[model samples]
Target: MGRIIAVANQKGGVGKSTTAINLSACLAEKGKKVLAIDMDPQGNTTSGFGVDKNGIENTLYELLLGEAETKDTIVKDVVENLDLIPSNINLSGAEIELVGIDDKEFILKGITDKLRRKYDYIILDCPPSLNMLTINALTAATSVLVPIQCEYYALEGLSQLIHTIDLVKERLNKRLKMEGVVFTMYDARTNLSLQVVENVKENLNQNIYKTIIPRNVRLAEAPSYGQPINIYDPRSAGAESYRLLAEEVLNREDN
Candidate 1:
């Protein structure tokens, strides 16, 4: 069975989606069958893989609402071994609609249960808020990977996220664990970035990944071109960093 990892962080602009898209691509490049799920209403992950959400039918919204199956909703990405379960603006209504439903947090889990064994990795790009959607992602995930930017407020809302994870582990999925925290948009020259890294290490004791994603313009531009960094510019620092991060994730599992 594949490892279901939710790329989650309640704080916005923390490189959660970017990490999800690129990590999935990098893992696919390394011969893993990857399925990237866009659980965010923004649909950035859907567009990141060159998928158009304008006229697509049966998105993640339908899957979560039990109106569609996981296989029926998955779309193939440009990458050979990578596939995606795209999301669109329609998903924004899921929070309100799912409220009165039974096992609301398990909707995603139910959808993925049958499809989990088909891929080597299932990467969920969670929304920026700790809502029902994120709860569902946490409930379905075997582990959560948090991408924390190298900024002043890096650790600000971490406590709340950790608390939520704890609650999910206790009440929803006991096997759910934190994979690790990755530092993105890292600027080595900035003392503040260094301080933020140290602070995270001090608190979590798991400092950060050795592969810090530098603030590269290409990284930001890739999504605009509807491509992952690996496909946009494989030799660039952004692509190399994500590939290294993918290897780090794979290595950690063996140890």
Candidate 2:
């Protein structure tokens, strides 16, 4: 079965979607069959792969609502070996709509379970909140990968997210694990960024990825151009960091 990783953080602007996009792209470049699911209503990950979020049909919304089949909803070869299940503004209503449904949290799990045999990795890009959609992602995923920006208030927000994960592990998915934490938006020039990394390492104290994503202009610019960092500027620091991150992920599985 494929590993389903939910790239999540309840805090916004913490490189969650960026990590989901670039990491999935990098892994695909490594000849892994990857599928990226954009569960966020903003659909940034969808657009990052050059899929027009607004104009797309048979999106995640339809799949979640049982209106469409997974095969029909998927956009294949989004970038070489990567496939995508795009999301759009329509997903914004999923939270309210799922409230009265039976086994609501397992909806995503059921959908992904059927898809496990088709890929090596399934990456879910969750929204920046611990709502029904995020709950579904967490419930569906075998592990959660958190992207923490090296900045103030990082740990403050993390505790709440950890608590939610604990609750999910206890009552929802016993197999769910915190895969690891990746530090993003690092600025070596700033003392604050360095301090934040040290502090987080002291607190979390487990599975912190060694690859620190620097604040590179090329990384931010790639999204606007609808390409992954490797395609946009393979020689840039941002691309190298994600490449290292992908290798680190593969090494972890190997060990």
Candidate 3:
């Protein structure tokens, strides 16, 4: 069975998709068979991996709606060992369509259950809202990884997110757990960034990652080119930071 992780955060612009894309790439580089699931309707993860969303016949939307199987929708990415179950604007309608279905939250879990044995890790890039899609991802995941940006109002929506997770654990998936919180877009020179980090650490009680992703222009520019930071600029600070984050996650799993 694979370790299914949902990369989620209710707050937008917090590097969730970026973390999902690069971390999945880095894990593949480390010889792990990885499947990146784009649960966000924005399809940033789909485009980030250089997948032509407009041309794809089947995607996560089809899989979730039981119109297609995982094997049919899964596409091999440019990277050697990484596969992607891409998403697009079509998924935006899934939320409304799923409303009438029984056990709608388990739709994603049902899809992955048949395919979990093929990959070492299944990374889900969740939408920045606690919608049905995100709930499906949460129900499908073994744990959730939160990417929190180092900003003044970083913790504003965290309480609600945490509450939702607790509710999911109580009612949806009893096995769901929090992987950890990652601090993203950190700036060492900014006191605000430092304060935000400290605040998150204090609130989460040290359930935060040691690797802080610094604010780098290259990280922001990679998406425009449809590439991960590691491929866009291997020598850049953002690339190195994500690589380190990959190692941190792997090491933590080992112990």
Candidate 4:
């Protein structure tokens, strides 16, 4: 079975989408069969892989509402071994539509469970908020990879996120675990970045990744070009960090 990793964070602008897009791409580059699911209604991950959201017919919206099958839903050959289950603005209304349904939280799991054998890693790019969509991702995932922005409000709501994971583990998906926390947008010149890392280490008793993604111009520009940092600018600091992160993920004995 493939490892299902939900790259999640309640706070926006924490490089959640960036991590999802690049990590999946890097893993694919390393020859792992990857399936990146765009759980966010904004569809950043969908476009980050160069898939046109407006031109696509079926998306995660159709899949979640049971309007489409997983075979018809998946966009094949997104980039080498990486496939995609794209999402668009249409997915935003899925929150209210999911109500009163039987096992709504497990709907996404039902879809992903079928595709596990075909891939090595299934990466879920969850929304910035803790909505129904995010809950669905959590229920589907084997582990959650959190991306924290190295800024002043880095620790905000972190405890709540961990608490939610615990709740889901206790009730929803007992297999769910914390993949780890990864620090993003680190600036070597700033004393604040170092402070944030040390603070999180002192407070949060979780597996933290050693590879820190620095705030690079290329990383910010790659999304606009509809490419991962590795493909967009292979020599960039952002690309190198993500590649290192992927190695750590692959080296892990748990998954």
lDDT of 1 by residue, 1-255 (tens): 889999999999999999999999999999999999999999999998999877689899998888987778999755879999999999999999999999888988877777787988999999999999999999999999999999989988888999999999999999999898999999888898889888888888553678889889899999999999998998999999999999998997788
Cα lDDT tens digits for candidate 3, 1-255: 888989999899999999999999888888989999999989999999899888899998898888987778989766779999999999999989999999999988987776789988999999999999999999999888999999998998898998999899999999998888999989999999999988888787536778899999999999889888888999999999999988988887788
Ordered from best to worst lDDT, the candidate numbers read 4, 2, 1, 3
Q: What is the C-alpha lDDT of each candidate?
A: 0.91, 0.94, 0.90, 0.95
Clashes of 1: 0
Task: Arrange candidates by TM-score, descending.
Answer: 2, 4, 1, 3
The runs of at least 3 residues in candidate 3 whose Cα sits more than 4 Å from the true structure, single-residue gaps closed, are none
Where does candidate 2 have its weakest 10-residue lDDT segment?
Answer: 153-162
What TM-score quantifies how close candidate 2 is to the native fold?
A: 0.98
Q: Which tens-of-lDDT digit does each residue in 1-255 have in candidate 2?
A: 999999999999999999999999999999999999999999999999999998887999999999999999999998999999999999999998998999999999999988999999999999999999999999999998999999897776788898999899999999999889999999999999999999998889558999999999999999999999999999999999999999998888787
Candidate 3 or 4, higher TM-score? 4
- Model 1 lDDT, full chain set: 0.91
Best by lDDT: 4
* Residue 69 C-alpha lDDT in model 2: 93
Tens-place lDDT per residue, model 4, 1-255, is 999999999999999999999999999999999999999989999999888998999999998998998889999988889999999999999999999898999999988898999999999999988889999999999999999999999999988888988998999999998999999999999999999999999999999999999999999999899999999999999999999999999988455
